[model samples]
Target: LGERVSWQTLATVLIGLLGVLVMLRPGAGLFDWAALLSLGSAFLYGLSQLMARKISDTESSTVMAFYQNGAYLTGALLVAGLFRLAGIEHAVHPSLEFLVRPWIWPALPDLLKMAACGFVASAGMILLSQAYRLAQANRVATFEYTGIIWSPLWGFLFFAEVPHSATVLGATLIIGAGLLAFRTERLRAAPPLLVPTGDTA
Candidate 1:
């Protein structure tokens, strides 16, 4: 906790964030209120990851995953139930409506897909917990940028979506940022050089 942060580490983080901005292709000069929601989510995520690293020493990955998944399920159900009980229906936009819509029994195929997602999510949590446990959080944290690359890759593979120039550039930057972080950390950890100031010992 008392460790000093090096400028190289800050530069790597800034580079990664720049890559994210490049990937997003934000509208020029227009502040979208919806973007704040993403900021809020990011803040919460930071807190979660911080706590994950803090307790990782004593908690098994399995235990952490169980607690996380349990809390997620409980919170989701409670929020949905409250919305349902309030009889609030907003049907203007399909996306908005989806948020407030009453819960319905999903079809068999949809249910199966949802179940599979739950399993995948739990597995992801377990893996995430292990990651924080095994390495310094800062060392592993920048790897999260890879998710941006994965999204476009998956789109191309499954949905026939073509990635644009910005996406390519963004991916390159993100990758370079990670490599820079790795290289910088290695340099810092390397043994100090010994030099002879005098001709005779």
Candidate 2:
């Protein structure tokens, strides 16, 4: 029980830190409130991931993804329903209907973009799970920091959003720290069950 609690707490802290970083980005109202909301999201997601890891050995990745996504979809629907019950027309209001409308039906190009995002995200998760099974969780989690390096290029190409130098520097530090910790943990562990490289040589 203590071990479980400790894992949950650590996950919460990492996620909370991520939230702080996200809220630092421009364009979210109530900087303080956004930070809080971001932290909450991070905490929940982190907890969910840790729980997923615990069960990964028992179930297939397809099963995990289905349940994980199902949970998220259910929560979203509940929220939407609550808002409707409260007589709120939408989560956020806009001056123009086009600006605020949900993209249930979009033009071809916009639909293509959404589809691409979904494909990339799903593929990334499959690869992530496979990596976790082969290596330690921390090691694969560290590689996720590479998104920081890639995000700027993606933004520049797709959205014309140039990243700040600070963002790059911060991301680099995070990636380095995560990788360093993971490598240290691996080193401390006993030798792999498989044959060593020297045996093959």
Candidate 3:
């Protein structure tokens, strides 16, 4: 665990965070408090990327995906069981309710829909595992910023939710940060120019 983040990398991250803050407008009284949870999730996801890279030499992507899904299923069931035992009948928040809801049998269509979600999740996990396996975690991780573009697009398509102007600005900064990271990483990885032993001119 001798990881050291350079100031340049830290600055790139801060720029990305600035973009998010611009979008969120936390000082404008419009920020959803739930985003704090997302910040925590981002930290954990970074740790997972490092762990995935560390283990990539010995494990196949499919194996990693399998275990990831298994752990998720186990953790979810444990949480649901504990919630049931605790007799928490109501969650004040919709998201919390989704998490602690009692399990029940569903119609075939509902079941199939849930199964499809599981399949997509497993495929996504496999792809993420492959990404970390094939690249430096720091460099590869920056690509996650590109995902910010999709959330707005999906909201527009599915929910008819129009993105605010700040969303556009934030998305631009986020994508720009990713591009800069890639360029920086590429430059750093390139061989240094050799000093001329003697000037031919």
Candidate 4:
């Protein structure tokens, strides 16, 4: 994996991470213990990508997606079981509450929405698994920063929320970094220029 990454790819990854930090703007007061959980999640995600790259040659993407979804389903069930058995008090914090909440049957409309969400998520995972199978992890990772551009667009379309200038600027940087990485990859892939060994007759 290390051997597969070039300096250009590393630079692009750093630039993409910089864009993420600029958007998040973590500060002294902004730091929260929950942020560590997010960081851990990101680390696991990167690890999974690395693992995908390692096995992609031998494993089918469908098989990868199947295992990934199975793991998620198992984890979700285990968490729900633990929450139920522990009988923990209702959490005041939204994140904690969501985690510990007991399962309940949703209304028909809500159930449909949940099903739709699951379908979309599963489809996305399958596509991502295929992408990892088809490309080097480092070469494709920078494109993940494109989420920064889509977030605000989705927010505006779905929730009528407008983004601040900082978001716009950060998205621009993220996109620029992705474009730079793609260009670098393209140039690297181009055939080397031929040099004449001797003067033509």
Candidate 5:
């Protein structure tokens, strides 16, 4: 099934993406390969949301989330094993270390924290899947920009970190873009005004 995106929606999407770039600020010396991975991940996520829309009528959100998490677990194990087999030194880089690090028994507290994280992730996946099930992909996707605002709030609350001016500005842009997209969608969905055939002279 093909869905056509309106020009307003496309413009707002571009604005939202621009805000993401501003927040990221990738440059020659400052760029990391991980940023590209993040971009690729976003693209894949959008694709997934679109695909979810097609199947949302037939498949339940719980089923979608189950398969999604199952894939994540399988991929993680496969990548970790491949990296370990390649004999990559853990000290090579933080990313490499993450991949090649040997599994160890964790303290009860650490295990609980990890479990909490998994719970939150699973809940989020279910909610997002349900959102796609209920609405157009573009409409749901635009609201993802709200994460820019939440990230800073979370960092401030949990890490005692203060956001820089650029972060604030970028977040503002993202929020604005989301609002614009919402307005565009609402206008598109609104019924056209009915005018009387006879006009007053």
Candidate 6:
């Protein structure tokens, strides 16, 4: 769900939206800078993936998987910490003092929702790792594109946030490209060896 294209593509779209706002407003330097930073990060990630594939032949797949998982976990922790800190700084405690104050811990429902989210997230990670381990890495990674196809559908079904026609079209193109690339890589990685004349009839 997170991997495929949603995580990066969605972030890129949001940053693009911010950039639009910055363009429309005269004094939005900070937003402009932030948007550029986000765009640059996404570009670098794409380049990094290309570089990784170039070097992958030299590294054990298991080691690569470990590093990938470790990076995911580290990113998750950082995001969680950032949100938790935001909540604390906003004095979102639901104690008596908070009740007396204007800031009440967003709400009991929100807190419960966060806990449920965390549980689901942990389970998803476990399942993803298991899935990766059970299949060839390239094959598993190929299927990750399905998440890109499904994300907008999920968003529309759950939040009534209909995706743009352009988004749907773009995702379809990307999925097709991913399939083609996967097939090409698979064939190249395990090309059939030829027999010598002595072995042939």
Query: What TM-score would each prediction reach against the true structure?
Result: 0.84, 0.65, 0.81, 0.90, 0.87, 0.43
Predicted candidate 6 versus true structure: per-residue lDDT over 139-185, tens digit per residue: 44555545555777888999999876666655655565455555554
**What is the C-alpha lDDT profile of model 5 across 29-57, one tens digit per residue?**
54677557667888888888788788999
Q: Best TM-score goes to which candidate?
A: 4
Question: Model 2 over residues 97-145: C-alpha lDDT tens digits?
Answer: 3333443778999989989987787776666655655554544555555
Q: Can you list the residue pairs that collide in candidate 5?
A: none
- Tell me how candidate 1 scores on lDDT: 0.82
Instruction: Identify the runs in model 2 with alpha carbons over 4 angstroms from their true place.
Output: 1-30, 89-104, 178-201
Q: Give the candidates in order of TM-score, highest first.
A: 4, 5, 1, 3, 2, 6
lDDT (0-100) at residue 150 of candidate 3?
85
lDDT of 3 by residue, 56-173 (tens): 8899999988987887789878978888888888886666577666678899999999999988889989999999888666656567766777889899999999999999999888
On residues 79-115, what C-alpha lDDT tens digit does candidate 4 reach at each position?
7787778887597565667776666889999999999
- Of models 4 and 6, which has the larger TM-score? 4
Local distance difference test scores for all models: 0.82, 0.60, 0.80, 0.82, 0.82, 0.54
User: Weakest 10 consecutive residues, lDDT, candidate 2?
Assistant: 1-10
lDDT, residue 99, candidate 1: 71
lDDT of 3 at 36: 71
Deviation of model 2 at 95, angstroms: 15
Measured over all alpha carbons after superposition, the RMSD of each candidate to the real structure, in angstroms, is: 3.0, 6.8, 2.9, 2.0, 2.6, 10.6
Cα error, candidate 2, residue 152 (Å): 2.9
Number of backbone collisions per candidate: 0, 0, 0, 0, 0, 1
In candidate 3, how many Å is residue 28 off? 3.5
